[model samples]
Target: MKGIDQAMNTLPCQGCKGLCCGPVPITGKEFKKIQKKVKTFPRKIRERLERQPRFFGTCIFYDIEQDQCGIHDVRPEICRAFGYHKELVCFRKPELATKEKISFKESPVGYLSIDFTWKDF
Candidate 1:
């Protein structure tokens, strides 16, 4: 998960920064969402994480060992939000980020060019 900590290079699940590593404050609603995923309530999860405070880390569902999650397919909403910040989308399947845009043209050439070309910097 390169976006896990903004790492330019991708990392293996086991090499990942763990599920709860960094500064990510959680609201009451967010807390409830996390509880639902972890199968625990807010009261029990109020304590700081083993390595860092809860306010400064990723979701508890993130698996540091495999660098993956035991509940990735059914992760909480907050985790979903992490993959999309503003207009930037970090799609894991594609392994890259994509900027959003609206265009009048969808293709060119045969069907219209699906490929995009831009001048180099």
Candidate 2:
């Protein structure tokens, strides 16, 4: 994961907005963690993030203004695997993708944006 983190650091993610961030598959544990994280945010910050506009398929936790994941620290396994695994290659830097594919030990309970929403938290 550290090696993948290093590789992903070389990506030009700042200006790309959340084009690569879409509805993500997350486990029940991840959901609980995210719920905790979101709950920690101040009311103003939480509302601001929730009000931000995103592309049709974008993740709900995507911070459009900051152009990054709102809950990066507790992001799901698939989010961490993204742009590193062959199955989750980054379009901007495809070479950074590893030959291996990602396999989750625990199947996702639901998708972040599609199945769960701000109301769930």
Candidate 3:
């Protein structure tokens, strides 16, 4: 199936580094599907996924050299959902654009926090 990145026509991801390729949460079924295509899951990656079965760190499939998803065709659903969407607030935080880690929290009371962390992944 075509991932959302292709469906949305977000080719090249202009003006933005591959920040979206950071830690992403996915369903157990999705992980199983991904495992079939990806071999040699790192210990750190496996631990993280064990702790939070839904979390996939640094998208093991991302091709840093190409600056795009290596497995774009069967990438996790969470990866597919990300992009220049209206509900995303990360784009506004330009300073954190090139960082290794990006996180956002939104509350019902109109409060938002964007944090960046330097993780090994």
Best by TM-score, which number? 2
Q: Model 2, range 23-119, lDDT digits (tens) per residue?
A: 7888999999999999999998899988998887688988989888889999888888888789898898888787597778999898877899889
Residue pairs with backbone atoms closer than 3 Å in model 3 (clashes):
none
How good is model 1 by TM-score? 0.34
| Model 1 stretches with alpha carbons more than 4 Å out | 1-15, 18-21, 40-59, 70-78, 83-95, 99-121
Backbone clash count, each prediction separately: 10, 0, 0
lDDT of 1 by residue, 1-121 (tens): 6575666543233444543322333344444444465454243332222233222335444444445653455543434444334332333423433424323222212110011111100
**Candidate 3, RMSD to the unseen true structure:** 11.4
User: What is the C-alpha local distance difference test score of each model?
Assistant: 0.36, 0.85, 0.45
Greater lDDT among 2 and 3 belongs to 2
In model 2, what lDDT does residue 13 have?
Answer: 80
- Cα displacement (angstroms), candidate 1, residue 37, comes to 3.4
Return the TM-score for candidate 2, rounded to 2 decimals. 0.90
User: Tens-digit lDDT track for model 3 on 47-114?
Assistant: 44334311234544455455456556767654555643343325534322332333433222110011
Looking at model 1, the pairs that clash are 13-66, 13-67, 14-66, 14-67, 22-56, 22-57, 23-56, 107-112, 108-112, 108-113
Order of models, best TM-score first: 2, 3, 1
